[model samples]
Target: MLVPKRNWLQQAGFLTGLYGQYLKVYLKTLVEYRADTLIALVAGIVAQGSTLLFLTVIFQKIPKLADWSFYELVFLFGLAATGKSINQAFFNAPFSLTGYIRRGQMDIMMIRPVGVLLQAIGSSQELNGVGQLVTGIAIMGFAGAHLDLQWTAGTLLYVVIALLSSAVIQFAVLLTISVLTFWVQEVRSVIYPVNWLYDFTRYPLEIFHPLLRGLLTYVIPYALGSFFPAAFLLRPESYGWAMWGVPAAAVITMSLAYCLWTFGIRRYSSVAG
Candidate 1:
């Protein structure tokens, strides 16, 4: 019997449907553990709220930080927090890649017909991100009310695109680090220190030294996912490049991450082997 091959669109639809099924099961599990989910959600909010409180205290001493008003900083922090929440919600399973490799879980995923990356992503959902998502939206709304900005349809669309692209960039960077587990077997030592760099993006890039600015803009590029998007919205004349650059960076970094992921999979050897 000959089987017809599905086109890209059909393949994509299939993957999307499969992921939705994973989400449904995940939601069911969360519903069954309401108390634990609530605790996790509260913990996420408290952790993120503490950062906002710290910023509030700092702003009390000064009207502005690096020429950005407190509301402007809130917008930037909200943007970054939203992007991080999206990443944690949908793409955080790769954080356990080392454990998967050690426990021979990769073998099971490899034998499945689905893409390994998609399978890994669908294996778990970080429900705690729901709290961060809630906080980010609330913070953004609070800042938006205070900031003088035009809210045209184009601006709204651009904001959506920027936030989605920011999440893509974060996912790509984290996935790239996770892929390194194929070689190192334990990449957390590198992942944690690099992850801490995200904190720097919460503040205005102008406040940093040129070297650190360049590092964030080019080397790590977390600023593109956080600062640049908010900057573009807050000051289009000064940050016009971000309108396109953020999406471009997302595509470039994701391509590189997927290539690394593919390379890792090819070279992967099961623990039993």
Candidate 2:
């Protein structure tokens, strides 16, 4: 029974089909709220756009902040926004777990063949993140052209890894906070700090006081989501060590978040309606 029954392509093909069906259902619901989607998309665009504008205003007065030029800072902002948008698109929909817990809908997930976490995430998709995705790509491309990135194979590969690690780190933070719901029986309070953190990530981590820097880097490690990766991209030799730490930090923090989630699940008692 322990046979290598399917090759990697077969497994990937099956998963792709599953997600395709998932997206199909999501689109059916999405069309019913056409206006809401438009508003969300516009809000995402304005939000990221305003962040870039902030950088523009700052650079107009000062030559650079922490040795990062306007374009480089925008690249960091783009990294954070892209990673966040991708996470919103694929997972961590707002208020999903709260509804599940309070309504005892976890009972429904209990009998499903898929994992509860997967089912919860699969039930919601954020197409609004498209605005952020578009904005991020545009900024990154503009910054890349100005920065004159070498685009060597090794540098390109590192870029891919850094971006993926950034996404992983961001999602891990959100999930870790969301999983606190299993204890408190609510999510809003837990989710607030993470929401606040995005603003900090849109800028360089060094501008803050040392305590805040430590918090972002070590305690929470939001730095991995944008700053360090961008730092490595802009100044390779100086930030090489920091770049390598992103994936390692992602794995360690995500593993801890998963363990917390499983522990919370064990302790969970659903709220009665």
Candidate 3:
């Protein structure tokens, strides 16, 4: 008996439906642990709030840092926060790959019919990210109003595209790191340094030395996800390349990450063996 192959649209719809089922399970778990979810949400808000407080203190002492005003810095932070939150909310389960591998869970996932990466992504959701998502939007609105940003239709569309690309970039970086667990088995220390690099995106890249600027722009490229997009919006004449660079970087990075993930999975061995 021959089974007909599904087209791209049908495949996409099937994947979407599968992911929706996973989300339902996650939601039920959240409902069962409402107190824990609430605590996590508050903790997330306070964690991000402390960073905002630090920025407020800095701006009070100086009119601008690296020629970026306080509101401009806030805009950059908000963009990065939103991107990180989206990644955490949807694609954060890879962080637990080490545990899955250690417990022989990866073996089970491999036997499943769905894509391994898709299963990893849909296995969990970080509800705390909802707090950061709300805070990021509020901060962006506040800073944009203060900066007197002209929110034309084109500007709005660009912002939406920029944020989604930014999220893809972050997810690519983290997923690439998590995929390393197939060989190394432990990556918490490595993950922390990469996360610390994200803090640099909250400020203007111009404040750093040329080497550091190059590191962010070409090496890690986290700044491209958050700082560049915000900078282009704030001063389009100054950072014109950012309009195209950010999306291009997202596509390139994600393609490379997915390739790495595929290679890792192919070589992965079962722990029981």
Sort by lDDT, top down from the best:
1, 3, 2
Q: By the lDDT metric, which is better: model 1 or model 2? A: 1
RMSD values, in order shown? 1.7, 3.4, 2.0
By summed lDDT, which 10 consecutive residues of candidate 2 come out lowest?
Answer: 86-95
Q: Pick the candidate with the highest TM-score.
A: 1
lDDT of 3: 0.85
Give per-residue CA lDDT, model 3, range 47-136, as digits (tens): 778989999999899999988888989999988888888877877876777877888888999888778888888875788877788788
Off by over 4 Å in 3: 1-4
lDDT of 1 by residue, 1-273 (tens): 443478999988998999999999888877998997788778878987898899999999999998999999999999888888877877786687888889899999988778888988898578887778878878888899899988899988988888888878877887899888888858898887887788799889999999999998898889999999999999999999999999999999999999999998999878797
RMSD of 1: 1.7
User: The CA-based lDDT of model 2 is what?
Assistant: 0.76
**TM-score (all chains, Cα) for each model:** 0.95, 0.86, 0.93
Error of 3 at 23 (Å): 2.5
Tens digits of per-residue lDDT for model 2, 1-273: 343466889866866676788888877766888887777778888997887777888889999998778888888888778777776776654447777877788877866654577677677677787667777777777788888689789877777787777777777787788887776656787687776776687678778899988888887787887788888888888888866687898888889977887887777654653
TM-score-based ranking:
1, 3, 2
